[model samples]
Structures are given as structure tokens and as C-alpha cells.
Target: MEFAQALFLVVAGHNDRQEHLSRARRLVLKVHLSASLSEGESVRFLPPIFGEVRLIVHQFLDRLMHDSGRPIPIFNQNAGSLDRRMDKAEFDRFADAYEDQHRENIAVTGEGPEYFAEYKIKAFREIVDRAGIEVNRICDFGSGIGNSIPYFRRYFPEAALTSSDVSERSLALGRQRYPEAGSCVLIENNRIPVEADSFDVAFSACVFHHIPHREHLTWLRELHRVTRPGGLIAIFEHNPLNPLTVHAVNTCPFDENARLIFARDLAKRLQAAGWASSRIQYNLFFPRALARLRPFENKLGWLPLGAQYVATARKV
Candidate 1:
């Protein structure tokens, strides 16, 4: 009778453990499916499912380790062939639907795409204004569809504006949208197609992440080469440390190939590319819901929790 009772308890414990694991797997799969659908990918695709399975397993192990009070091991999943890199062609394809897709992705923030674009230009203007530096020529690097043209005109009316991008289709769209903004220059072979030391400011907004990590230095060097002495090279990028920023990137179709960089890392890259007085400033701390608190955002630039960051440096 004692042996039978012990056997029954062991079987019941094993069944409970199995049930727990099954529940965990279902939860992981549900989350994975939601994310995949949001990204505009079909769950029926085998590669994505396989990737999700890997993530699910890792998450389960992480939870187990946490419960055991042990340090969790990180697993970096190589996207392999399943993840394709975006290039000029991809940008061209995205150009037509970029605005609509961006609107949809950022709907949760209760702001339009132009608001984001304008803020970066506004922030850069403030930085240079405080330093008493007058910008006469501005080069908008990776100026997709000339979204920044109106803002550039609004803030730096006297400065001559030049737009440059790798996507010809996007440039065409920009030309149509802003005929008075002049011709948009095309970048070829990672080159800016412009004279050296020609601009007072070389600005890029959320463009670097789309670029290959190995080629970041080359592009930074190009921007440095185009910027005159005492001129500013300010770049705005999505802050990966912020959960909302991560979600934004994950859902944005154009950001499929994005590899986010930390502000400190970008600052170091700027130094490596022969830039001087490099500084990092975080931005977009408060959403539209809390616009009343935005006045305090300027004082919070040192905080790393902002939705995006601007890494600024000067050529000297």
C-alpha cells in the first residue's frame, strides 16, 4: 500500500511539470504570432516559426534560470538567410508607401511622421544657436522624400539646403513634393557625390541604422569630409534601450533591416572618423499624451531612456 501511494505521488508530480511546460510554450507562441503579424509577415512561413521556436526555448530557459537564482545566459540568434538586408532597391520600393506605413507604425504615439522629423532639425538648430554658430550651408544626408525640407526651411531659412540620398525613386518623390527645394543629389558607392568641406552642417535623421555596421565608419568619414571646419554633423537615431523605440522599429516595415546603435557607440565612431567635440543628447522623452512635460525634456538629455538620441560632432 505504501509503495503504490509513493508511485501515485511521483506520477502526479511529473504530470504537473509537463502541464506547466505546455502552458509556457503556448504563451510564447501566442506572443510570437502577434509580433510576426504586426511585422506584416505570414506565420505560415517556416523560417520565422523556426526562429520563434528558438526564441521560445531560450525564454523558457531564461525563466528557469531566473527561478533558480542563476545568471541567465544570453543567446544571440543569427538571423541567417531568413533576414535580408535592405539596400537602395528596397528603399525605392518603400518610398511609395513609406508615409502611410510610418503613420500606421507610429499611431500609438499619437503623432505624425512630420513631428518626428521637425523635432530633430529644431533640436540641431537650438544646439548650434546656443554655441553662436551660424550655419550657411546645410546638407541633409539620407533625406528621404524631402520630409525634412520644410523644417529645414523653417529653422534655417538663410542656409542653402541640399538633399542627398541613395534611392533615386525617393529623390524623385522628394522633387515632386518640394519643387523649390532644388535637385536631390544621388549617393553612389557609399560616396556623397559632393565637394569636400562644402557644407556648414551635415545632418542625418534615423538613417545610420539602415546602413550596414561595417560601413558606418565609411559613411561617417564621408559626412566629415563634406562638412567644413567648425560645422556640425548631427545624427538622430532610434534608442534601442527604450522599449517603445524597440517596438516602433519592430513594427515599421522600412526598419526591417535596422540594426540600432547606442549613443555612446555612435559617439566613439564619430571620434574614429576624425570628428571633434562629440556629444550625445537624448530626445522624445514624453509622448503626445504628456506634452505638458516636454518643456523639461531639454534638461533630461543626459538620460538614456529617451525614445531617440542625437549624436553630434564637429569637424575641426
Candidate 2:
């Protein structure tokens, strides 16, 4: 059977909205007609024209539920193609939907709110303190729901705080939760509305993994641009190599499209963005069952077995 025909046959039995089914049928016909094209008779069979076939196949289930209007632009031309950046509007839609779905427990995934609020944020604070970076003005990029507010207050009560994110719902909730944040900026198109060299300390927790890998260095450069020459930028991301971290992200509805990043990879991206003194420190080595072992996690920084890692670099 032809490729598009086979794909249509596979999806034909599924129950879906009429509009969705119509779109799917049209999509199938579009590809089937493309596949049926005859060779140019150059004594050679032309390579198959699979213009948007790959996209339809990947998003078959997604099309059944909601249409993203313009399908996400697929820059990859083949299986080996690497570019995966999404347009700003698409990312904004994703962020808005994700936050709306998980607003009640945005910070309380994997384990729960108590553990995330106490252990995870506390460990990040310790990492920051140990690095001994002075904090006067701080910006929490992608600070959804302001889960880090309490910890930021505990770590540097007097520092000016700014919470920024693409989701207005998240920013509203953050502002409600942490009134002390003088600025609750809504970011668009990866452009931070704040002035350059405005913050002394810029940090993001579990934010980069949600960003497409192709734009990682560009975002890092933005972080660097907004930070003072001697300021610090700390990035906390899920450790891709850790099984529990992998499972958590894979299972989390909000993280359905997330791509976990490695500590070394994050450090390299920061370096490429003109950051200096890049360092990676692994954390969350033990589950709550072995809470006492947490104290010893400091010594295991050299090990890459942690559930998450923090990459710290100085802006130059």
C-alpha cells in the first residue's frame, strides 16, 4: 500500500470530532496525491515528495483533539535534521495551555508541593550561597506561579525581585502569591522586556528543558545580555541521564513536549553565549525515603547521577 493510504487506514478507525476527521482526511488525500506523482521519465524514480507527511504522522493524535491553526513549522527535512525551534506564538500557546491545565499544582509535580517547595528550592538556595554571588537585583526568568518566592525571600530578603514568564495566567498568579515582586513582566518571543545589564542575579529553575534545544544558546545570550558584566546566571534543569528525572518529565502532562538537557550541554551553551567561569553542580541525589542522605549530596557534586543539576556562569 502507498504510504499515505496506509497512514489513513491506520487512523480511520479512531473516534474524533468531525472537523478533525475532515482535516485528517484532507491531509491524507494531500499526501496520497503527492505520493501518486509519476517520475519525470529521466530514467530515474524521483525521491518521494513528503512535504508535510512527517508532520501529520507525528501529530495525528494531536490533530484529533485540537488544531494549532498553523501546524508548528517543521524545519527538519529528514530523520537526521536537527533544528527544532518553535515560533513564538506557538510557544506562547503551549505555555498558556500548560499553565491553565496545571495552575493548581505547577510547582507540585513529581513528588508534591511540600517536597518541591522545601527541598528542591532549598537545595538551589544552598547552591547559590555556596557560589558566593552577591545579589541586589534578581530576576527569575520563567518564574511560573512564583514558587521560588519564599526561597528568594529567605536567601536575599532585601533584593529587588522580578518575575517574568510568557503565560499571563502564571504571571497573574505569581503576582498574587508574591506581592513583593515589584515587576511581573509578561515576556513574548524570547525577548525580555527589561533593560540590558539590569539584574545582578538571573536564574531559572527547570525552565530550559521546556525550551527547544535549537534556541537554548540564544536564550542564554538573552540572559547574559540582561545581566551585569560581573553578574551571575544560574540555570537549573532536569538531568536527562537520570531515570527518575526522565520518568517524571515523560509522565508530566505539562512537560509532555519537554526535552531534558545534560549538565555539560547546558554549560557549553552558556559558554557559547559569552558566559565565563561556567560550573555545573549536580543535586537531588536521593529521594525523600533517604532524606538524611541529602546532606551528603554536597560531596556528590562531581557525580552526574543527580536527578537535576545547576549550571552557574558569570556574564562577561
Candidate 3:
């Protein structure tokens, strides 16, 4: 009787150990699957048997998920790659869900993607109007899906608008959205497919940050080459100095590889690229909570605390 009781206890203990291991495996697999589908959350709980090995398991899972052939959520996909350039292929992947991702990322600002797009175009128009520049032809450089097309049409109805981007799929979507655009040019080999001195105004909305810093001068020079002498080159970019802007970029899936530039730094880059009379003006000073204070934002451009900044230069 004593021997039988001992045997029964041992077998039951073995079965319980097996069950724990099975449960732990299922939990790890669940976490791994979730990591593949979305940005992973913190691993807080594990089977008690894994007490000492919990940290090791976490590290192993991180490496495994990173190598799983998909973009890791909230992390730059190029972090481990040799080539860190944000190329056409990367943007092409983002083209389909660009607007939805953008809208979600900027939801904290209490505005839609369209609002941001329209505001940048509106700011560009105001800059040219103040300078008394007559823009007959406009180049929407880096015009992803032509988000600014409608606003461009609204602001400069008479100007012939040409949109350009590195991503073919984005251009396809843009064409679908706005067939009335004068032209959609594909950028190949890091070159804008247009003749020299083709446009009176070359505008880029929140595009430079995605570009590798080494290539900024090349594109800037390209923009300079495309714009007519004395024409405007206006660039809108997120201001890194703004905490809110930093948070927005950090959370934005598309901006995972973004390298935000200071307004002053962009001005210097513009000068080096053969642009003259470069100036930086900050905007979007107030969130929706302070909508009443938006009228005062224009006056605050010199403060450098706005969510974004527009760097404008003349091709002289």
C-alpha cells in the first residue's frame, strides 16, 4: 500500500510538470504571434517555473520577432539592415495605409491628415503672397498620394501643378485621387524627372525627414535646379524641438525612420544647395484645446515652439 501511494504521487507530479511546460509554450507562442501582428507589449508575466530564465526568454523572443521578416511595431525596420536609406520600396509599402496611419498618429492633435496637409499649403501660399511672388507653375515635390493636391488647387487655381515622388504606388494613388494634376513625375536614381528651371514654386510637405541626411543636399540641389530663378522653394517639416511633435513622430509607423531636422539646420542645408534668402517660420502653435489662440500663431513663428516649421528659400 505504501509503495502504491508513492508511485501515484510521483506520476501526478510528472503530469503537473508537463502541463506547466505546455502552458508556458502556448503563452510564448501567443506573444510571438502578437509581436508579428502588432508592436509588442511588455512581457510582464511568465510561468513561475521560468523565474530565473524569464529575462533570457524575453531577449530570445525579441531577437526572434525582429528576424521574423516583418516590420517591428514602433521600431525602424531598417535598424538592423545595412542600407538604412528610406527608399521607394519602403514608401511603397506604406502607400496603401498611409492616410489611416497618419490620421491615427496625429489623432492627439485633434485634427485630421487633411487639416495638416491643407495648413502646409496654405502657409506656403501666404509666404509667396507676402513676398509678392507670382507662381505660374508649382512643383509639389515629394507629393505622397497628392494629399496637398486639393489644397494646391484651392490656393493656386491658375498655377499648373506638377506632382513628384519616389514611390510609384503612391503616385498611382495620387493620380487616382486627382487626375486633374498637370503631371505626375517619378523620381528615379534620386533624380527628379523634370527639366531645369521648370517650376515657379517648388514645395515639399513634411518629406525631408524620411530622406537619408547624406542625400538631402542632392535633392535640395535638384529642387533648386528645377525651380526658375527667383522662384520659391518651400519645405514644411516637423519641428523636433516641440515635445508634441516628437511624440507624434515617435508613435507614427510611417515616420519610424524619420530624422527630424531643426528649422535652422534645414535653412543651412538649403543655402548649401544653391538656394538663397532662406527663412524659417514656425507654425501650428496651438492644439485643438487652444483653438481660440490659433489666430495668434502667425505672430509666434519666431518662437520656435510650434509643432512644425516651414523653411522657404528663393532660387537666386
Q: Which ranges in model 1 have alpha carbons more than 4 Å from their true place?
A: 1-86
Encode model 1's per-residue lDDT on 27-76: one tens digit a residue.
55565556567664564555664664446343543343244432111111
Sorted by TM-score (best first), the order is 1, 3, 2
- Better candidate number, 1 or 2, judged by TM-score: 1
lDDT agreement with native, every candidate: 0.77, 0.67, 0.77
Per-candidate clash tally = 0, 0, 0
lDDT by residue for model 2 (37-96), tens: 533543135444343434445344344334544321111122112555443343445544
lDDT accuracy of residue 263 in candidate 3: 81
Which ten-residue region of model 2 has the weakest summed lDDT?
71-80
The C-alpha RMSD in Å for every predicted model, in order, reads 13.9, 14.1, 16.2
Which candidate, 1 or 3, would have the higher TM-score against the true structure? 1
Clash pairs, candidate 1, are none
Q: Quick one: best TM-score, which candidate?
A: 1
Return whichever of 2 and 3 wins on TM-score.
3
Q: What digit string (tens of lDDT, one per residue) describes model 3 on residues 254-295? A: 877776776887999999999999999999988788899899
Q: If both were scored by lDDT, which would come out higher, candidate 2 or candidate 3?
A: 3
